[model samples]
Target chain A: MNQEIRDGLRAAVPVIISAAPFGVLFGALAVDNGLSVFEAVTMSATVFAGASQMVGIELFGQSIAPWLIVFSVFAVNFRHVLYSAAIGRRMVSFTPLQKGLSFFLLTDPQFAIAEARYEAGHRLTFRWYATSGLALYVFWIAETWLGALFGRLLPDSHALGLDFLLTIYFLGLVMSFRKRALWLPVVLASSVASIIAFNVVGSPWHVSLGALAGILVAAAAPLEGVREDEANEGRADA
Target chain B: MSDGTTLLVILGAALATFATRAGGHLVLSRFRSIHPRVEAGLNAVPAAVLTTIVAPAAFNGGVAELGALAVAALASLRFGMTTLFAAGAVTLIGLRALGL
Candidate 1:
């Protein structure tokens, strides 16, 4: 096995664990919403975005217009726009085809882990990205199939703490980035803003709104890194 | 909805979702040089976006959820990723079992 592939698998374990329940839940709900097991599995394999897929099924259950459901799913996943833009900066070595394939698997955790690796000064190679992404993709689809087939037999999710695992997982990811510049203020701003948005605006919207608030804070803060680089350049020129 | 319609809708969403995923990079790449402020903002992306997912859950949670997160945060300071995750999951399940 390639070293980066091994590392990618290592990075993927926590994600697979935290995401397992939701994948199963999504499949069960998709079936309950009138989707065939095939369709449920298809959606998992194709759309591949959990929150939006959930939104799609919920709307499907309501017998909403198909276009409306598609639009809603798009709206729910709009945050990926920001994620793609942010992570794209580090993909200098990726071929055009690799970039295309990479974007297809660019889920929230994938982006977070890739960006963290880059920040730690590691190269963002295609091998590692594809390895991690494919591992997640396979688990998600398999879990969806299992849930569609046997979701009802599963134990109580709430009692098992399945509902809150991602929250715990994400909090750990956020904590891992504490060494980054402006991390605390960014976390504070996004947290408070998301809480407000989650209450008032609703699901999905809160993510984008909350992230924007924090990014604006970072953009407007004193340019600690850039300023020092410029000062050093000025001294060198003199 | 018919099976055909369901498939169509799912495919439509897949396209739409892909657009958003690829759209940002396409738009950003057009710029020859990114401004420093923009770079700073991009650097904050992981923390900023991830915090939103975590915060609302923490806020809406009751005793069990809150306790788990608290345990998890503390565990993060001393443990590896898997250990902290286990600590958090154990705390959540334990607290919920205790009727918190």
Candidate 2:
């Protein structure tokens, strides 16, 4: 294997390992919520993002219109736009095919690793990111299937309090951000907005409002020469 | 929903997600440099987006949510993602087991 690919896999292990519980959680949630095991596995393989899939499944359970569910998934995943923008500038010379595949496998973890490397002066080639991203892709897909099958065996994941895994998972994801001066205000603004929006707007739309709130705060954040959020992008959680 | 319906939704989600993933480069890669402010916004978005989900759950939920998130948040900042996750899961499971 290429050494960077090998390094990518090595770097991906922690992320893959960390995500295992949520994959299982998603699988279990899908089966109980509305989906068959096959559908859950398929979603895991293709959709990849746990939060959106879970929300999709929830909307499915509610018998919401299919079009609305897709829209929600899109809005929740809009963060990938920012993710793609952040890294696209760094990997400007990649072929369209390379960029497509890399982005297809994109998730927060690989982005985190890449951001850290880029900020630290490591100029990564397409293969470095592709190999890393693919590693996470495989791990995530397999775990989703396992969770679906095993969750079926459990009869009621809620009885076991597995439902709480969603909130617990969010804790890890939220806390993964690098602590900085701008972090709290951005978090506070988005979080408050999200709560209000959740009551009025609902799942995916609420997420959009929250993301927009955070982006706006970040854009106009008052500070003097402290580029902390920049240096800290990929520094946390790994 | 039928199996076909579920499959369609999943496909839609996949396509939408893939679109976002590939979108940045398709549109922005032609540009020579990223604006510093855009980078900051992107950098802040992850935490901001996630906090919207987690912070309220921690504050609103009772002992189980509060304990799991509190421990996880502290552990994440100090230990790392995997460890904090383990800590959070353990806390939630323990609290539920104890009827908290």
Candidate 3:
């Protein structure tokens, strides 16, 4: 293997390990939410954002407006905007088309590892990026297919807590960001607001309403003595 | 929903997500800097949005589920993603098996 390809695959190993469960879980959960195996695989292949895909499948089960589901997916994935902005600067030699393709694979860990690479004084090569990204892409699709097939064979989803696994998964995702600024207040506000919204407004609305409450609190919080760019880096392994 | 609709929603979401991934370079890069508040809001997006997904589930869960979440949260403070997730899964399954 070429050096760039080798390095890229190496960089992706940890990410592949961490993300493996979610890939399979999303597949099973997608089927649980009524997606066909093909659709589940299609989602893994195309959308490729784990959390947003989960949000998409969750909403798919609720009979919410399709646009709203798409919107929720968009909202969940909005963080990629920052990632793109931050990582774009490091892709100095990438052609416009290469940059477009590169951005498509820009998941959380992709961004972090690439940024880490850049910060460590290496040139971010297209070969390196493509190797890592495609390795993840192939595994994601394969796992989704496996999970879908496995999900089909399961007799009782409830007994095994398949319905609640995503909840635990989501909780794990939330906890991963505990080191970020305003993490506690943001979580508390969103949690309280979502619970209230779940009671008053209902299922789908809580996601948006609760998220808005938390974002507003964080944005409006006093910035006195706080470093401006402190929020920029993290594992973001999800 | 029809398969067609499901496919459509998935495609739409992919497009929107792609725009975000590409948009920052196309649009936001033109700006020299981002407002601190805007940055903070963006920073909060993952935790805030993910919390909404988790909180409602925790609120509606039975004791086993809640215990699992509590254990997961504590484990998160000291552990990596896989360990914390496994800890929660084990706790949840064990509690539910004991008829929690």
Candidate 4:
């Protein structure tokens, strides 16, 4: 294998290792939240968005409307659109099949790696993305299965506050972009909007409203300078 | 949740999640040259979206938790700790103390 492929695989291994415990946690939580083994495993296999899956289970436990649950999950994960767009723009040179396959494998960490590669002017192909994705896929399914089997046996995880893992993960992600003052306002506004929506509209709609508010506000704000700065940085790195 | 209905709901949720995850790629596949406006929108979307999601978690906590996250963010900026490590460390400490 070429060095690029080797590097891609090397990068992907850490992600897979990290995902293993997360996957197991999801699997265990799904069962604890009252999903059957098949149901939990199927959801993990088919859906593959960890946060949305957890939220869906929580909503279901609370007897929320199914359509609302679906909508909420969609809203929470809408950022994938931007990720897909970024990858799609670059994969324009590839074939339709190549593009489709790559799209299927675009998860958060994978997208992060891919973007870093792109900004570095590295030659990232569909195959590279696919390799990383396939690795994650295996770990995800395995972890879910393990969790479903062993999750019920475990003690109260809520007391352990394992649920806060997602929160911490998001905080880390947001902090990474804290270089600019503009992001601080964006974060504050969105948080306030989401909290208000959560109280007013309640469960599912709260997520949608909060996400919409954030998207609209961020888009309308002046970000031309930030964009130019990022592009310049990317060019300099190249 | 009825078992049958729950199964259906789970399936629906999974499908919905997949759709959103896949939606952007499907939309972008047809385009050759993306409009500059669309590009701008896409670039800003993550910051907006992530900010919305993270805000509740960071501040929803009590004063101590909020303080910890603030400290973590400051540490990230000043000390140059990786965002993930710093945030994780702060949350671990804060939540442990809060007994949440």
User: Which number leads on TM-score?
Assistant: 1
Question: Which stretches in model 3 have alpha-carbon errors above 4 Å?
Answer: A1-40, A49-99, A106-136, A147-151, A227-238, B1-13
Whichever of 2 and 3 has more TM-score, that candidate is 2
**Residue by residue across B1-100, what tens digits does model 3's lDDT show?**
9989999999999999999899978886565556667667766766776788789988898999999999988998898656787888888888888999
Judge the docking of candidate 1 as incorrect, acceptable, medium or high.
medium
Q: Which ranges of candidate 2 are over 4 A from the true structure?
A: A1-18, A25-39, A57-69, A92-94, A108-128, A147-150, A155-161, A164-176, A179-181, A226-238, B1-9
RMSD of 4: 5.6
Q: What does candidate 4's lDDT look like per residue over A168-204, in tens digits?
A: 4455455655553356666666678878876777654
Question: Candidate 1 residues B22-99, lDDT tens each?
Answer: 999999998767777788899898999999999999999999999999999999999878999999999999999999
Model 1: residues >4 Å from true position, as ranges? A227-238
The clash tally of candidate 1 reads: 0
Fnat of all models, as shown: 0.84, 0.69, 0.72, 0.43
The TM-score between candidate 2 and the true structure equals 0.77
lDDT of 3 by residue, A26-118 (tens): 899999999999999999899988878988998899979999998888877876776776678778799999999999999866776675466
CA lDDT, every prediction? 0.93, 0.75, 0.81, 0.65
Per-prediction DockQ? 0.66, 0.54, 0.50, 0.39
- Ten contiguous residues with the weakest lDDT in model 1 chain A: A229-238
